[model samples]
Target chain A: MYGGGGGHYDGGGGAANANSLFGGGGFMPSQSTAAPESSGGGSLSKVGPERADAAAAHREADHGRGAASDDKSNFAINSVEVSTIRLVGRMLGKVERVTDVAFILDDGTGKIDVNRWENESSDTKEMADVNDGNYVIVNGGLKGFQGKRHVVAYSVRRVTNFNDITHHFLHCIYVHLELTKSNSRLPSQINASTGIPGHANQVRLPNNQATTFSASGNTAGNDVSSLVMSVFHDPAIIDREDGITVAYIIDRLKLPEEVIKEVMQKHIDDGNIYNTIDDLHYRSAMNG
Target chain B: MDTSSPAAIVNGEILNKFVGRRVRTVVQVQRNEGGMVFGQSTDGHQLTIKSAMDIPVSHFMEVYGIAEHNQTIRAEVCTDFGPNFDAKAFDGLCKLANDKFKHLFL
Candidate 1:
């Protein structure tokens, strides 16, 4: 879940995703277009239970740590009551060759060598099981293997749970660092929502490509060029008509008239519109 | 745990631009919800601006208050919303953001 440094206008505000929010801080999706639905294509619902569960686990399993403590998909362990943890990542290499039935699955955290010795069903490891690019959630029990951490799972699920709700309810920005593809297996993981790279995914990144996510912004406007985003805000509340009001503290000059008009529509209501990536720059080039 | 004066790190514009005093840490601010404030300070507690009247919202700060509980300086509000920066620790966080807590900055 990483890599998405957005663009800036003429007076940038110091906003970490912590403070500065997109679309004026609304929490729903915008649905007010006369045009066809697929025109600007985006999701409209909140992330579902399983994906949300994985997201929490993903936050815990951030930046490559040990497997026992790496609660990637089974996050509610601390807050919620449950067993059978969930995990997500790529199947690195055949543990003992492609059909040997045992291998390491890198869940952005550390490699979790998985093995199903007793019940190796021929159809179990489908295209979804070994497919490297997509995200998946696996449920299983932990066991030690050759000093490396391992999980003996009875089941696995893919992250293809996309639906009509997904296209409009945007929550984050995840960037797929272009360079990760060079290696036979991209070691690092990229957040499809926020371009901010995590250590779980950082372990496999080639050195030079490591810093390309959040802070690496020589890229003009810091645009989310190839990043993935969800359109989750309700447009009825955001008043984009007044345009995106960016407070320019440098020269006290607000967002330029053109930049705001370019991205937002007019007469936006007030409670939705938090899925923007337009960057804000300083009026005076003090730091630049 | 000395309640005498809060050990603070000043990163605000008020201390830098206005006060030549250079508040390395603010021991405390006298909050009244009344009367235009006249400053009170000794050696380490001294501030440049006698009052918060002149500072802008972004320019000024009243970020911390002595934690009556354990004396550990914490955030004014606990929230799962907007950047949850514990204002007191702002100085300890490097400009480059290199720690778990510092990720809140990024």
Candidate 2:
């Protein structure tokens, strides 16, 4: 009953044959999507069982590392759990051995040894291109051996984009801030305050709740940018033709003069505000 | 290789914070004279780098060394970042790393 006019056993043929049966459509539907309605159900069903077995094998392999709860000492920086770390740095030195290869990497913040272990399926030929002074991106797990910590590298590739060097450092800083500052709101505090019955054990608190906590916790420190703009956007001052003066903002916010000036300049440059009477006086773009 | 003391990245503006400590910064070389390089830092401050090797003028050089003073670096290693490097972005990175996220590095 198949459209291509072949025996039922001929369904074992792959996409090309399936395409013909589907009236020569240019786009190829994936096996999983095609399997349910297609006439080649038998062959596709066989592939399904094989895929299931492979997935099972993959799950078994991942079981060890996936047990994050059991392993309390899993690699962490600033008390944030990090399973894999990606670092960009200059390769200071390299040592090759039969079982593994080790290289010292210096990324300005610190220097650490990154080791890539040899496997029967993979060859160390790719590492031949890496040399001293070459900047490389190392992705791996952090491990300690005999009291010395080193990165057990999964892959080491030479950096082609010059921007990656700067990007890596910025990324490190971003992740550090995300972990330490943003995620510092304890789950216990959320439980104590909110009393959300089901969310007592949940680590990921609601975004609004986190915002509320941070807003209430450190008003003067964290929200300086927003606080600066609030003066310009204030209902009382928003309609002023000459705009709000920097002195008024400083007096209202009670922040340092330098910070007020810097934030004002940034907002002006960003087109969020513009000069109304002079550079000293500014009006929010939102006012118009 | 004394890798234990990893250099903290600094721009001209924040060099004073890392005095007597290992630091790294990118500077655009303005002139070179007698083993000393005078350059403009990413943050547009004048920096004096003490180097034994000849440094290329008008090129961006990443200097890794001890911060001798507010605007001086005792250069241990210098890598030429080429003349076309982005100074403004690097300056922003330095500021963010030092100011908002100082705890991450220090």
Candidate 3:
């Protein structure tokens, strides 16, 4: 009996064919019939904002890395090829049992089979209790067998608040944009002069678009980096929940795309931003 | 009107055109508090709603509002849709979000 907006649920069945492995019938686990262990949507209030805050911290800590490989299990829906992937979604069907019980997880955009092997001593009890039509977060590696994608879950937890689903999707969009839009620049010498730890790596500049601070000197590159940082820190740009895009930067700052790309590359190099769902999108490292 | 059609404004640039105009669009509520709700449109634009109405999190709405300064909108009216709200029409919207939008995740 959820209420607030007085409308109806219209689930259009026409989704792009989800990358689900099976159409139906594989293995049905012994049904847990347990009333879902719910937290009454308590996480709803706080989860959304935490994404930006945490992403900011994540960017700061891994300023020079190409990917968060060490945290590879932190998977999202589009990360199907990344072996170390983690995700959360709704359970689509009755638990299926084979050598290991499998639960089909649907996260709107895609679907993947998550297996809970009988052989493992990891958190099986909690996963076993998850019911169909409930939300869940899974941590695991992506796998391919017989041309289908599968996930061998390291952990699965019931999602109490529905907001987490939206939050997860937004986070994904944020990452995709950051990964694709920001570019790396030649490491600047300003860090040594300013004494900021990893400052060269931290100085991500939209080198081409940052002509506003044009002062001819060896420090021109550093000024460009500062300009790019200003773009990210702009409250009007940062406040949007959808994050920022390269096109938006180009239009708002009257900067050229080539210039934007260079700054984006610089951001990527400094770990200030990473590509989001695709290459064109980006968010600030501070709000990563 | 087909509410299911893909939004023309796929990104933030749409906001520039909508400012000062009363427009109708579908949005998925990300957070709502203190007479304001932050949301993202299906085509990938950020939306901030300021309204006297109560807006719930994780629900979709066919919102008629005026785009104020920045990415924010001052809502004139918001029509909610989903399982607990309008069961007749929102099932498709809800399903579409869960199926396609998941890729936005990392």
What tens digits encode model 3's per-residue C-alpha lDDT throughout B22-94?
Answer: 4445567778888788877655568787892675787775455666754777876565644233322233333
Better of 1 and 2 by TM-score: 2
C-alpha RMSD of each candidate structure in angstroms: 23.1, 23.5, 20.7
Give the DockQ (2 decimals) of all models.
Answer: 0.01, 0.14, 0.03
lDDT of 3 at A273: 44
What tens digits encode model 1's per-residue C-alpha lDDT throughout A131-204? 44333344344433343335555344443321101111111111111111211222232222224234234332
Off by over 4 Å in 1: A1-83, A95-100, A117-129, A161-288, B1-106
Q: Which regions of candidate 3 are displaced past 4 Å?
A: A1-81, A94-99, A118-122, A182-288, B1-106
Q: Rank the candidates by TM-score, best first.
A: 2, 3, 1
- Winning model by lDDT: 2
The DockQ leader among the candidates is 2
TM-score of chain B of each: 0.22, 0.90, 0.61
Task: Quantify how close model 2 is to the true structure by its C-alpha RMSD in Å.
Answer: 23.5
For candidate 3, give the lDDT of residue B57. 81
Weakest 10 consecutive residues of candidate 1 chain A by summed lDDT: A164-173
lDDT of each: 0.26, 0.52, 0.40
What is candidate 1's TM-score against the reference?
0.23
